[model samples]
Target: MKSLVTAIQQRDGRALQAMSNSVPLQQAQPVREHTAQVFNELFKQLRATFPASMANFKDQEDLNEFKRQWTKAFAENNIRTIDQINAGMKIARQQENPFLPAPGQFIQWCKQGESLAVGLPDEDQLYELYREYCKMRGWREMKWPSNACYWMVTKIYSEMRSKSLTDSEVIKLCAKELRSMTARIKSGETIPAPVKQIPQLYIPTSKERSLEHLASIRKKLNLNPKSI
Candidate 1:
């Protein structure tokens, strides 16, 4: 029964269904009902987590279209194992590739987007969640972590790379450079030249720029910048 909870947590509905089938008919009925309830709750949490995206598909037709595809994929597929089911669910939940930021730019994303905390916890925390989920399923840890785990590792590496210049050793080296530069200036010696800035050319058009004019121009070009 606890395995069903784990399967649900892992979004392995097919695994849950398989586990449910293994139980006595009477037992399976109640378990299936409970699993279904849990699945609904998970979906509600997902919607809450991504309210902005969900809002875009608030219309019945769009919502139904999404549900229809989801249902058809789950129904038509024969998921033979727990892992396979897990993989399928992962594919379904895959978000459009989000823009990644450099360590210096991360602060800007936090300020600009609601997705700031989407992957709040580090990879270790998520791996712990996976362990707990697997334990509840009465399953032993696998010899190797799944591709999802590897994905987490990759994210951690990306974060580490982004912060490379801020590492203690690198920072110390930068401090040395600054000191060297300062000493040269103090000694009345010539310092290294600074980076040159290129001024951008700003050309103003004669046409008035307004919402009305923009709309007219867009209509003429048959282009919708908003769609981009």
Candidate 2:
């Protein structure tokens, strides 16, 4: 583990890859403990090296959250090897904001918004923006259906661009609605479903002129307007 940490610190890609391939096929308990130790040391080295940027977690909770998110991200990206770990850490260090929404959390927010019919932006639009965000982050190498980082970054940017509510605001509104519904239920009062707004009909500006032109043409042809 020390050697792996040293190799990672030195950015020795070959050595890291070798170490990753050489991990022992031991009992489940021992393997889990060893993997945890390796990762702990790796994270320590990363924090030591990039204190200002990627490792700027606010507290232990924040760090743990990041770890949870990044662990999922790594697994989803199929980053099982040491070389992949090193590469991911390098990319993370270069990220402008390494902290973003977890995938499950972002999806939950979207689902809640949809269920409440709160006028959330279209899912296709959100996905398009997410792709753009990935490109900007130079994460094109990462697999699609990206991890939580991509989802969170895209959600933040889309909300900002559209002047939409933040996740916290949405969650608060949903909570309030739920509480109100619960109260009504306990009081034996009727609870109404949320109303869906009717979309406005579209009228073309040239419709009247086109109709008049068609009438004139019909008259020139001596056709009965009503019968035609």
Candidate 3:
């Protein structure tokens, strides 16, 4: 059951397709269906991951019984979605041993995944994306992971633009911001819509315009009451 799982993209020495977008998992596709499909996929992946540990289940009957029990236990623990299953597998892979985990222990892993159920990439992944966002800020068509990500990175970039900082310094600030945003999202707060960029009103100073130009509009001192 032990594997090295980092929620970052598979590239750049990370694991967990949790950040699957070219920008977020299995390439960033979310497993929203909480059904047998999810459970079956979880079993298949876990079996592949822990072939040695799960080798004891040599027959279909044994595997079926294991699935039945696990499904019931998972339901009791509210592990209804594949997102939670993916997270649980992530936790499972990070362990040091190859032994299969107890149902209770696996459930704990599933709980940890719940924290990630907001469907946002982990901090480090977002930081990497933020770096790319900075590099490609000039590109008119860049695919952002989500509106929340676009919003977060845009704010981060704006805040950092004036600072003379290194990657470490930037990541420190970015991580904090990412955490706050992730927490808000996990708490069911929707990312507020991006505000439209209001154009700056070009108001010329009194000196920028000639007094002659301003004086062109003459005002009459008295109204012509009798004239049409």
**Prediction-by-prediction clash tally:** 0, 0, 9
TM-score of each: 0.21, 0.25, 0.40
Winner of 2 and 3 under TM-score = 3
lDDT (10s digit) by residue, model 1, range 29-62: 6645544443344346446545666677768898
Models sorted by lDDT, best on top: 3, 2, 1
Once fitted onto the true fold, the runs of candidate 2 whose alpha carbons sit more than 4 angstroms away are 1-38, 89-228
lDDT of 3 by residue, 1-228 (tens): 123342332234444332344433342234323445667878898888899978888798998898877776776766776677888898788899888888788876775555456666656777898888777766445577777877888878887877866788888867667656756887788787655545567787777576434444322434343332
Judge candidate 1 at residue 213 and give its lDDT: 78
Stronger candidate by TM-score (1 vs 2): 2
Candidate 3 has a TM-score of: 0.40
Highest TM-score: give the candidate number.
3
Off by over 4 Å in 3: 1-89, 94-115, 196-228
Ranking by TM-score: 3, 2, 1
Candidate closest to the true structure, highest lDDT: 3
lDDT of each: 0.43, 0.50, 0.69
